[model samples]
Target: MENQQQTWIDLAIAAMDKAYVPYSNFPVGACLVSKSGKVYQGLNIENASFGLTNCAERTAFFKAISEGEQEFQYLVIAGHTPDPISPCGACRQVMVEFCEPTMPVLLVGDEGALKETTVGELLPYSFNGKDL
Candidate 1:
């Protein structure tokens, strides 16, 4: 699976170059692989109002959903950090909307190292509307 993970890492690195981060300068990139074998990429976009910033993960998810894609297999998140970075709480919650709890999430660091995990493992008590 290293080869496949590398592919995603490459895509994410490419996407990071497209990020519009003028405020925080913290660019993040993400790529999601749909169940249909389609891949979607996203880059963090920031605004003067910090609250308006859109995370890389959500950008990918929103783009995929907008294209009528639903089912997802895994997602890769890349950042220019030494260690693999995890998604923020908001991004994790948004992922729960479209991804299965078992969906794999690969966090890639700038050193090309990877940390493999699942959405459920990241957000065990996710509120997926099952109780609502």
Candidate 2:
């Protein structure tokens, strides 16, 4: 992995430590880099109502978007799973909404393994604004 990617992965891991996972005990973290070079970190925030729980990827995206950072450069998601963590379907749809098709999406696993992919690759033929 490139130095920058490693740095993002480390940030995601650090963010994971802050996750609030009382129900599933599954913690996840995400780091989003904007086109302007701003970085946003997010951790899973679980709620008593399972349906209200938010994933780390959406948290990061919401944070960046609310802060007026629209164009994203990269995204890194970290988890303690055996393999590199993949985003949930909702998160993938959000990625398709806000991220460029070719934007890099990095997944980091418990052993620090890395899997690099793109927004489009994650959800091929996704429904978007164009489909409306």
Best by TM-score: 2
The TM-score values for the models, in the order shown, are: 0.96, 0.97
RMSD per model, one decimal: 1.0, 1.0
For lDDT, the strongest prediction is 2
Instruction: Estimate, for each residue in 21-128, the C-alpha lDDT of model 1 and write its tens digit.
Output: 998888999999999989999999999998999999999999999999999998999998889988999999988888899999999887767899999988888898
Q: Residue 85's C-alpha lDDT in candidate 1? A: 84
lDDT of 1: 0.91
Each prediction's whole-model lDDT (CA): 0.91, 0.94
